[model samples]
Target: MTRVFITDDHTMVRRGLRTLLEELSGFTFVGEAGDGATLLAQLHHQQVDLLLLDISMPRLDGYSALVSIKKEWPELKVCVLTMHEEPYFIRKMLQVGADGYLIKNCPREEIVKALETLAEGKQYYPAEVSQLIMQDLVNGTPKVPLTRREKEVLKLLVMEKTTAEIAEDLNLSTHTVDSHRKNMLQKLECKTTVGLIIYALEHGLG
Candidate 1:
């Protein structure tokens, strides 16, 4: 059986999900928590195969908690079941290691399907999530217009090169390299290094 845990600030939400998941064969509801901290604490004593997470909670939000959970429990699968449908949140969650992203309004069947997919060690993003990602790509400026130097910097950045290393390799000062990184981030609408890397990989620029 797959042991699943639910973490959300809403008691009703947790109870509702628990009810739905209990009726599904092979899925066992292990526990539930009202916030991220309590959820993390519960993991210390429980064996969980998957975590159904919420983005907003008291004590610690889902974003920070997700990062911590992945760092400490790399084997655990996390599926974000939240109300946030914005492309920015979806990208940010994926960048931070979410195995799946499902809007709170997703059909009950899809939620179970997402959990199943993640439990099998595969990523899952519903059709709505795909549309959001595609919208972001279409609305954002084309990356091909970037200058050669900027593209070089982006490639090195995706390779995990530090600012100093990029500067040395390109024969530029650290300040200049930082400027390039900032510009790339702006042009790509990326808020973090991981986001930039994802963009590069998605566009085959990496």
Candidate 2:
């Protein structure tokens, strides 16, 4: 039997998923949690085959939680179900060791299928997730390994905004924006703002 646990901030979401999962045979609903911290605590005493987790939550976000869970239970299966459809977050979650990604609005059947596939030691991402991944690959944008903040800076800089403008928008000091600009220039191998912008455009980071 597949032991599945649901970790989401919404009680209704957990209840609905639990009900649907229980209707499916060969899978057992092991537990439910409102946040990653509680999920972590539960895993200390329970054995689970799959974890259906949300992206945004207190204590620990889904990506970070997946990293921690995988370190503790290296074989753990985690399927990230989130409302955020941004490719950046999706890529980061997968890179950080999530087994699968699904938008929160995904169909119930697809959610079930993703959990089952992951539990069986296979991998699956919802259609929307796969499409974004393919687009990133085809455009060669996903290879740029930058922190979230770095990517944000790249986006703003590509729009011809100065470091001070980006600083104000991101609520950071001008010095910090300058530092990020330098880091971006070094990482992107661009000597000028125009060069950096062009590089970002070419790589689809903008």
Cα-based lDDT for every prediction: 0.87, 0.84
Can you give the lDDT of residue 197 in candidate 1? 88
* Candidate 1 deviant stretches above 4 angstroms: 131-206
Q: Write the per-residue lDDT of candidate 1 for residues 1-206, one digit (tens) a residue.
A: 89999999998999999998889888999999999999989999999999999998999889889999999999999999999886667787877899899888878889888878887889898887777667767886233357799889889998899999999999999999989888777556578989888988998889
How would you encode candidate 2's per-residue C-alpha lDDT over 9-110 as one tens digit per residue? Answer: 999999999998889988999899898889999999999998898988888767667878989998988888889887767877877788888888777889
Error of 2 at 148 (Å): 15
Candidate 2 pairs with clashing backbones: none
CA lDDT, candidate 1, residue 7: 97
**Residue 95 accuracy (lDDT) in model 2:** 71
Report the C-alpha displacement of residue 59, candidate 1, in angstroms: 0.5
Task: Tell me each candidate's TM-score.
Answer: 0.65, 0.69
In candidate 2 the C-alpha lDDT for residue 151 amounts to 84
